[model samples]
Target: MASLAASLRDPAYVFHFLTPSFWSFLIGVVAAGSSLFFLALRADEQGEHFATSHNRDQINEAIRAMPEVVASPKRLADEANQGRNELIRQSHEKHARAQRAWARSQRYKVGWAASLTISALAFVLGYAWPLAQLSFFGAKLLP
Candidate 1:
């Protein structure tokens, strides 16, 4: 425990860990994991939508109930058109929601990747600049 505390007080270690690079990398990893989790959630929702949208038992029952209406060729055509339209509308709504979820998931993924890249660059620049400055001045900047 004492040695651990002493190590924590070391300037080199402190400087390395305190840099933006390390922090950025940590945050980026978290963001990437979160995005991946959200993507899984979106995928699950899409499957659910597919299951619910494809179930046409209720529509079949409604269609089977109209014998007198079915007697007319015109009413049969209208019912068929209406049923097709209803299915199309439901499909459009389901697809739109799934697409929105996919878009959101992709955005999260992009953010995660960007954060990691920026963090790495920041770390490299931060770690190098102080040493480069000290070299230019021909002096020890830190003990």
Candidate 2:
């Protein structure tokens, strides 16, 4: 093991130790890419959930307005159109709320995609820049 120890102390051995190979760099790039992809997917899923909840709220509001709309339609229609007017107002409000939720969801999706893209790009550049270097002589020596 004395020979092995002496070889490890050599400058060539140390340099090789410091330098990484193309495959190692590729592995790092792949890992970063997968992580970014997962993050983007997660953000999209949350956005979908938000949209679904907003729709449900709108549906519930409409259902609640049903009984009032059915009760005394003839009289209510003439009395400042009470039930119909209220239903229309509630419908508009529910639509506005759903619109707002959709807008927020879209913003979240865009931000998540942008962040993931930037992170993946950074990782790729970091790995590729050093990988381009070609080692000579002691490059073949195994640490």
Question: How does model 1 score by TM-score?
Answer: 0.47
Query: If scored against the real structure, what TM-score would every candidate get?
Result: 0.47, 0.45
Model 1 ranges with Cα > 4 A deviation: 1-75
lDDT of each: 0.55, 0.56
lDDT of 1 by residue, 53-141 (tens): 44444444554564423436787767756766565566567566656655665665565566556556655665565556556766442
User: Pick by lDDT: which candidate is best?
Assistant: 2
**Which residue pairs in candidate 2 have backbone atoms (N, alpha carbon, C) closer than 3 angstroms, thus clashing?**
none
**lDDT score, candidate 1:** 0.55
